[model samples]
Target: MSDNLQEDQQQAVLCDMCTEEDRKPARKTCMKCEISMCVHHLQAHVTTPVLLQTHPLTEPMASGAAGTTKCPQHGKLLEYYCLDDLTCVCVSCAIEDQHRLHNMKTFSTAHKELMEKLNAEQQALAKDENVSLEKWENGEREKLGSSSVRLIEAVSKLRDIALTSVQTSVSARMVSIKTSKSSMQVAQNEKDTFRFLQMFSQVHQDFEKAKAVDLRKGLEPGSDRDKLVQELRQGGEEMVAQAVQLWGSLLILVDPENHQEVFTTSSDLTFDPQSLGIGMSLSKDHRKVFYNSWLGQLSAHTLRIRSVHSTSNFQRWMVSLSEDCDWTIGLCDKESAENLKDGHVYGLRCQGNQLSSLTTDYYDFTDASRNLEDSSFGLQKVEIPKTEKKRRVSSQLIKCPGESGGDITPRPQKVEVFRNIAASSLSFFSRTGQHQRTEILTMKMSFDSSDFFAFVNLEKEQAQKSSNQPPGPQQQWMCSCGKVYIETGSGYSYGGCYYSKSPQAICSCGRVIGGRVIGDPCITEVVCELL
Candidate 1:
């Protein structure tokens, strides 16, 4: 009895592992279902382990609708497949109007066919994805290669632009340097002229002093005085000749790169006797006076000359024209109290190709002569005539020879001494057709021009007197109206645009006007007589 009870207990435990089914034999154990069952009762078992535990059935038919197909579109069991329309259909669907044209087949056959087609479509989609991925990778590589090349080209172009900028800058600097070189040459020439003029004046002064000493001593013929006189004469001539040469003009010299000369006039233009005439006439005041040959042509005009004893001899002259002749006169000399009443001196003039004289008072030779006479007399006879002095001005810095700092050569001081002398001398009375004995002199006149003094061969003598008197060392050169120094060359300075090696850039206006450094600046005279 105990053995029967143990066998019954083992049978009960084994029965606990049966599958659920309504009506079928559970002959096999379903490993995934976790069930064990007798084949004879398995057909009615429920499908899941939970259902099997509760119902305790043993049947293959327990899995409801096993091997049955479902329709995705209708959510219904696929009872049949329509071969003509290529669709699954239930028995009810086939009888309906929607499936009327569909040919029916078992659900098992339709399921197998649908599964094969779905697998083929998935495989095709995977292949297409791989091809698209390859194309995308190639495009990325091409884009990267193009970008690298563009970057390199951009860098090279930038480098070239930088180099071009540097070259342009260098060129501009070189041009500036060249311009500076040209201006320096002009300043140098002016300074040299100043130095020469100073030297010329000293030489003339020495000659005059020597002559004065000989005259005062009144030497005997056989004595050393006679020999000294001869020596002094020769020395004086030599010194005067040197002084005359100082008046010779200069030229503007150009560099070898530009071999051009600087001046326009080349005829050695000097005071020509052909252009002037002197004659004496008795004035209404019973004074013997002088008039220019040309002055007589101005409607029967007559000019008078008069002399006054001063430190230097003071001379006065005046012109009177017929009331019919509408000729105007101007003085070319500087204006001063003494010159104002003396006379209206005429400046050099040209009309209808005939050279004449202009009347102006700017170069009032009468005043200039008065000043020179007073200055020469050492303030004894006449208080030194107050003269208008030129203010000294300087040029920009230039590299001068033997200079420590850059040289600032001053523009030459203008002295109207020669003009004054001319005014006074010309005022001397002279008789018509009388052979006038005169001394030829070399006078230094300061002129404001690109050239220095005009080397004019002027006759110095008393216009009326032929009496033998020692010529005064301080003689005057004058005009009937006034005296004027010749102004030649353009007023602008050549080679004055340059600056020197200095920290400050000098302004262009700082340059001084000067004579030409390389050419003649005056007209030549064929014949001239001296007083």
Candidate 2:
């Protein structure tokens, strides 16, 4: 009897619907109703569709524990989530209380939505992390490679200097030793006693001088060669330390979230006069570049701008090109510019009717046409054939490069270039019109050094007038009388409104239209009409 009473007392949860006289153990708890039920009462929750859907069932819970799931004021299960208040509320709280008219969703639906948003955020974060990691790895590799190259070059130069010094010292010592031995041999061959004695002192002095010569003097401490070695060692250590510090700084700057902040728009860029090739001339302000044929040479002339070094940070700039001219614009480091052939340069080139991303192993510095046969990278060559549609006269008037006459694709007037050092990307854009631009191409290449410069190669067929030049006499004109005239020169002749090189010119309507002094070579008065 005591064991039975103990067992009954050990059961912590009891059915709420059961009477105290015949209490039954709980099977499941309804969170919505905040009540524990035995199997007999729980059957309603399983069989009833509304209860199964609306009421969330859980393992048997104690009586007072369910109070937390209900709203404090309404004493109802908090089954709905209020989006506006970012809180959980019961149906009564959502519809009849302060949450009335607020955006709301079922608790399960809100949880699902939150989960989906979290998943998307996780995916975006992962992608950003991957990109940042790739950039960091590439930067490390490039930095290591360039540093190794510099170190190797420095060591090789030092080796050559040391070797040359040692060889020169050895040669001089050998010559002295040979001369001293020859003099001693001559002195030993003398038969006369007096001649032998006379030559003995000089031979002895020569022998002593040859013996005193130090073969390792050039390599000794405080010597020029020794100083060069010490300097190289100290410089190498300093360079390594500086490189490590710079790497740490770069790591801090390479955050994907702040990558855009690394880029800067520089508008005050100017042409580097020293980088201009023959036949290339810059305007007074070093902004505009003009290229004229030199002695009928068909080679291209290259001009470079003193823009930001590509390895330092991201940079962007814009350039305007002359219509109907062969041009190539790109970035090149100091080594590449000096040795254009067999050097890597990233650029976009427009040749004849074809536009392509410039990628060639061997580009002739003096001739852009030589690069046409080279393979292109990233963007495929797009041949822009002449359109048959009748276009504006301005576009048709301009001739293609190397073409005496004929139409071709309209040339892009402006180009915007972006150099992203961190991303190792070079992007090109063609400005189609005001506030509109189309991406030309994006090249992925490493900027190994800080000596990168913006380069442009232009080959113009002939000297052309500026696009801002005034209109000619062939422009249509309209008079105040609403009369339209074509091919009207400085003087007009229409409906007896004759204006010529006279002291005074008048229109048929008795209005003074134009005037010029008689026998004067220049017109004293000029009148312009709008059409």
Count of clashing pairs, candidate 1: 81
lDDT of 1 by residue, 1-531 (tens): 698975554344332244434433335443334355564434545455675544322223233323234455555555567877887576567776578666676655666777888899888878878987788667755755555455455555544544454455455445544444443444445567776566555445544543343222234345554655565566556554443322221111112212221222212221222223333222223321223332222222222121222233322222222111122222223321123224334332212112232222233222334532355657655434445633221112222235588553221111011224433322111111112211112122233322112221112223432346323211111222222112222222123343332334222343222212232211111111112
Q: After superposition, how far is residue 85 of candidate 1 from its true place, in Å?
A: 10
Candidate number with greatest TM-score: 2
Provide TM-scores for the models: 0.20, 0.34
Global CA lDDT computed for model 2: 0.64
The C-alpha lDDT values of all candidates are: 0.35, 0.64
Tens digit of per-residue lDDT, candidate 2, span 1-531: 697865554367899999889878988889988899988989999999999999988677787888788888988888889988999899898889899899899877898998999999999989979998898788877876776666566667657766887787688778878989999999989999999999899999889988987886665444776777887687667666555544544544464221222222354577787866544445555665443332233246666677434445777777776554667788776655654433557787766545656553322233223222225665655554332322111101223446666654344667778888778778877666333455667777643534567777765553453567334223222333434333256665666565663447555555444332343222211111100
Clashes of each: 81, 0
Best candidate (score: lDDT): 2
Q: How accurate is candidate 1 locally (lDDT)?
A: 0.35
Which parts of model 2 have CA positions greater than 4 angstroms off?
A: 1-28, 35-40, 48-67, 71-76, 82-87, 90-103, 115-143, 146-150, 153-531
Error of 2 at 413 (Å): 36
